[model samples]
Target: MLRQYELLERVRAYDPDADEALINRAYVFSMKAHGSQKRASGDPYYSHPIEVAGILTDLRLDDETIATAILHDTIEDTVATPEEVERLFGPNVARLVDGVTKLSKIEAQSENQRAAENLRKFLLAMSGDIRVLLVKLADRLHNMRTLHFIANAEKRRRIARETMDIYAPLAERIGMYEFMTEMQTLAFRELEPDAYQSISKRLEQLHKGGGDLIDRIGRGIRAHLEASGIEAQVQGREKHPYSIWRKMAERHVSFEQLSDVMAFRAIVGTEEDCYRTLGLIHGRWPMVPGRFKDFISTPKRNGYKSLHTSVIHDEQMRIEIQIRTGDMHAQAEHGLAAHWAYKEGKDEAARTQHPWISDLVEILDHAGSAEELLEHTRMAMYQDRIFAFTPKGELIQLPKGASPVDFAYAVHTDLGDQTVGAKVNGRVMPLRTPLDNGDQVEILVSKAQHPQPTWLNFVVTGKAKAKIRRFVKSKEREETIALGRKLFDEIVQRLPVPLGWEAIAEALRRLHLHDDDALMEAIALKRIDDVQVMEALLPGSAGKGQVKPPPQRQAISIKGLTPGVAFTLAECCHPIPGDRIVGLRREGTGIEVHAIGCDRLADGIDADWVDLAWGNESDGGTARLCIVIKNEPGSLAVITSILGNHGANIVSLDQKARDGSFHTFTLGLEVHDVPHLMRILAALRATEVVSTAERI
Candidate 1:
């Protein structure tokens, strides 16, 4: 732990204007506050906060940030209160301390829920001042470093998982690569001990066998660069074990197959030299195909910039190289902290501004559930991103494979809802077309356009999907409320006086509903029946105003099956809208629709049969098709696209059989009628992989 005077001197070293008295007060106050407390590591608890403060000093953060770090735990672990902190240190430091405090008192639904809720609160707090997140991250880092002393294995793993899942990604999102990498390394060690130990052992053996190989590689690179008239500082080190293990898992390759285990960095004096150094390095070695990325030309969303490349040296050894200027190297190492180092005492609004932070704020407002907030924020933070542009040249960073709909949503919710089509790079493209780096996207909008259920099929971003779902849900609720209101009015048509919104409001208490809208929506969804609604409006009037039911079933209402029409059973395999039907009339029974292949019509001498077809009243009717498609990449997408083109929506698809060459899919489609179904089948049959497509 840093001593009081030593910590102040370090702070003053970077931030010469840092408030020494404020730092001294916080340091002494925290020590006294945690007077008798001991951490699981059997050290004075104040040491943890002091260490956290020391970590922040390395970033050259403002004095208040460092003070917040020192007093972060005082509110949570000690009897010290935010009010007291405010009285002593002012509201800014108190608020920062309060923001870092954990939500241990709130009763949560589950452990996952607890985590999600905590993240939601933390995000909300951090949005006001990013310093909160910085202090919290420092605290978590110190805790992770001392995690081994916890003794409880389960508790340790839980902390490690949370660190890996949430904190590491957040650090990375903020461009804190050093923090992200170290946290990931520590968590990976705890989560996969066996793999970690095995990799560590292998690394140790390699180091023992190769005497100073890293230093040798560094010297060789430095000499090569100097010979080419490029003065540079070159350094080499082995990749982290977790990074190596991840590559092995993703590529399904053994450790022996991995060649580029060591990474080297070349820090040049200027940006021009960074590229010049890259050209010279490539000239000396055989370049590895498809192993280069020019981040300098297109910086990451987090503002990370470098020229990354891989080369095969000495005809066998593969090595990864990074070339950047000294300033770029510093920014890459410290990330957002780099900005603070140059701009001291910048206000929260200026300091906290970031695309990812803006996205998190949007998510905090729009996410449907605690789990969803957690999920979307995780996706927003962790995914490898690609940059796409609007026609106006505004950059939109999205996860790789994000579709145009994701682009539209990232632009604005209104634009996404009104999007009817899109043009990528001046060419009309499919909505599911994956955007690449620098592709200019123009979303075509129409007043008639609204988010379709199918948009969810292709959108990859959490923000896009969440907004789409919210729109669909809100629209459904509005429609259901309207329907319920219509149903309620019909029920009250014969009443003494018409049941109005005012009357419903009065009866809400008796109906066990919150408000008029709640009652109406419930009635619309049939959760609360019409009779119950009528009775609640006028007490003891359940049957008085209710119309008596007809002797027979008034009208066969199967929601979407029959829009507003009445239908009788078609016994010939129950010919519904999708099946080919023939009407048959028995002696006294009404016209009955029968399927063409009904067994009852074949043997039995049935009544006279008449040709029948589904009426125009039908909106969507079920149709069955037997499809044989080759088992290959995108086969299913092709079939679905064909159907979608012909205005068919797949209700369900079941696999009947599969061979190495071909697979049979039994698909149920919600189509207009038999003719519409035939059109879909025709399109499917015309597809290349589709060997056979016929109505079943």
Candidate 2:
């Protein structure tokens, strides 16, 4: 039971005119709202919110942020209203509470969706103030710290997976390195307990004397800086447990391979002092080649600016050193929140100052669907970013493994829609080429070229997928509309009445369809019958309630066809069940059924053909027949006309070209009887360019 005065005192250290009355009111309201509620650990639920507030206070968040933290869990876990929060605190506090509250009520169908939705909500809230996410992150950190109280292994793993996938990366994106490392370590411990323990034990054993070593290094760096009259604060920090485990897995190395497990941060007062400290450190130790990064000049997208270098402290020892000014250090730890003071002022001015903040807000606003919003949020907030450059040298930050297609889309939807090809570092590369750090990319655009379905297979970023989908759908809609107009024209030409587009639109709307394009696309796919549209246009149509006529069955069966007998239709000459069929009874269960002109039998079977007659009843079946026809337009129409005249049903028809100006159609059809089938085959054989008509 921590007192409200104590909390206010801590908050007042950061915000001089800290609202004690408001803080106490929130504390009392939260206490009442969470009355008799308990956590998984069976502690008073109020304690959780207190801890969350304490976390925000440590971050030196403003009074409103601290108040919001107190009320964050109230709406979710207790009977508290956003209105009440707004009345008690303000709209800002209420919005934060509402943001956190929405995340608690999302009922995703699967664990993956659950995680994605949570991340989406977090991002939406963060995009608004950025403080909401900071509070939420603090909340998650506390939950993770006490996760062991939850007995279920599956629940534990789910929480851990969500933390790893969303929270940890988000922490990194915002430059909360300490929180990110802590969350990752906890998540890794839960997700892969055995591996975590193995690596953690090794790290502990290896760094047995690490505390003293870190103290000595810190002191030495501080003394060297002081001697050089450079004001700086140097502190040593070890790599988190999860980081070590990840390094081992990524590099496929044992713990011993990781030499620079501990790092020293040199915090100075000015940018010049930072560089001076870096020089002094380099002069003291041999700097490792290709191991230095100057983020000061080119700050990270998250506003993290620092200079990093790795060096060998001794012949056998490697260490990392980070040099940054006090402002840079604050920016590194607090990220976008450092700009909170500016944001709290004039709204228009705030938007102009941090335009990227507004970009984030727009991303939240213009997200068309929940899934898309979730995907964009994850990529933008919770993934490792690769910083690439446009040909103009403007830096673009994208998720790791983002393709040139992603970059094209990031530049503009119109550019992405027109992108035909891309060049990386002056070399022509595929659109799917992955960007690396510091690489310059140039996208080639063409109005003639459009996105292909295959682009979805490689594009990694959500924005790229959304733009491609939008472009493709727009083109498809246009094409379908055109096709629909053409189809309508053909329909009107063939019909007696002059039907207009509105009438067709009405008919389609009756079928629960929205527009002409949808109806036209359905017609093109053969999903909607052309005759159905004609019937709809005509008044009191007889075909409206009519069902498809069942195939007329021929009552003919082969005699002496025993049950449990296996029979095969000859490929050389296929026999339909309705065709005049003859069965050759072999010595065993294997029997051969064929149409009269089976070429294999004409050549003569290896065994003697037995005299078998047909029964009166014929089973419903189809036979394969190959027909040769003149390769000309409407040749298929002529063939279909012949079948329709005979009332023969064509099941499947496949045609392939035999040579120049000649084609072969392998026809599958149902005939009423053997005589009917025979007559049809005879008629096909007599047709022009009919090289052969055989049952096969």
lDDT of 1 by residue, 392-470 (tens): 4454667778999999999998999899889987799989899875577899999898887678888998889998888
- In order of appearance, the predictions have TM-scores of 0.56, 0.55
**402 Cα displacement, candidate 2 (Å):** 15
Clashes of each: 0, 13
lDDT score for residue 244 of model 2: 78
| Runs of candidate 1 exceeding 4 Å displacement | 102-110, 114-118, 342-696
**Clash pairs of candidate 1?**
none
Off by over 4 Å in 2: 107-109, 125-128, 341-696
Q: Whole-model lDDT, candidate 1?
A: 0.75
Candidate 2 structure quality by residue, lDDT tens digits, 1-696: 456777888877767666788889899999999999998999998988888888777777777788888888888777787788898888978887787776556523467445444554445445445667778888899889889899999989888888888788777766676687778888899999998888778767766845477788788889989999998889887777788777788988888887878888999999999888889989999999999999999877666899999989853588889999887887777665555532332243443344234223333233344344333333344335565656544446577788888888888888887888998977999887888755678899999877765688889888898877786666555554444444444444545456665777678766667766677665433355556666666543425354232223222234333211234556656665545565453432234666766666765454434333355564545667888888778877878888899988998988755678789888889876667878888887777757778876
